[model samples]
Target: MSFEIIGKTEQIELMASGKAIHDLSRLEKQYGQGKWRKLKGVALVRLRNGKIRKAELHWYEAHGIGKKEIKRKRYLD
Candidate 1:
């Protein structure tokens, strides 16, 4: 299923301008599928300042959580 942000561009811009960061967890919950893989693990990104970052997939869980609760993995490349 395709994921959609439920807010307008102005709302997004407002959030971006604030100290509070966007929630990736919410985005993934609404749009993610396909074995719940990490996007950063499979894709490459370059910052505007010319810094490149790489990531690796990892399995993690919080206390009192089950394996199925494992969230997206991330690592620096």
Candidate 2:
């Protein structure tokens, strides 16, 4: 990500899971597979320029694989 997640995420919701995730195959090949899910949430982030902001984040996660490919979707404030 271009920014660092400063704290815990909030309002987390599942956008997709399992076969519903279009990138499921790539996620498995890159990170190993186990009930992979595409999730979204809002969190405080520090941008590369050292500015802090609340942003919506999206990523892929699995039981043992942890979170991968985290991206900042948009700024909340």
Candidate 3:
């Protein structure tokens, strides 16, 4: 499943606990990993000065635990 963030980016908090890595591992265990691909929509990230920037979603994957592990990369536009 994909997540869409609403509201200001400042309101969003990134949890440490390796959540992102774990999630990607789980996804790879479920589905096979493949070449990096581009997503449809752009993500809005807020800077410290309250500036919003658009970024492209790039998804890549690697083999892990006999399955594919996925990693998401965001490229600023």
Candidate 4:
């Protein structure tokens, strides 16, 4: 499964310009595959300026053939 944002990136006013994708294999190793369904966790990010921010995590669900955004959650600050 993958994710896509909802707008034209060039048009966004102030989107995060830098990104760091973490290797979540440790997560799967710690907590098996059973918890991923219907549970969109929060993203804990540390910006270059040294401030921590949280972002909502959205996931797509398989329907017929295509997928849809079926879950979302707000991150805690």
- Return the TM-score for each candidate structure: 0.22, 0.96, 0.26, 0.24
User: Per-residue CA lDDT of candidate 4, range 1-77, in tens?
Assistant: 13333432221122111122132344345543322222244555444566555656544322232223333344356
For each of the candidates, the C-alpha root-mean-square deviation to the true structure, in angstroms, is 15.3, 0.7, 11.8, 13.4
lDDT of candidate 1 over 1-77, digit per residue (tens): 11211222121111121123244365346544222321112323344566544433222222243223222234346
Candidate models: Cα lDDT each: 0.30, 0.93, 0.40, 0.36
What clash count does candidate 4 reach? 0
Q: Candidate 3 lDDT, tens digit per residue, 1-77?
A: 13333353332222222334545555545665533222233456455566556654333343342312212246456
Runs with alpha carbons beyond 4 Å of true place in candidate 3: 1-26, 30-40, 59-77
Error of 1 at 49 (Å): 0.7
Q: How well is each residue in 12-57 modelled by candidate 2, as lDDT tens digits?
A: 9999999999998998898886999999999999988999999999
Colliding residue pairs in candidate 3: none
Residue 54, candidate 1: how far off, in angstroms?
0.8
- The 10-residue segment of model 3 with minimum total lDDT is 9-18
Clashing pairs in 1: 54-77
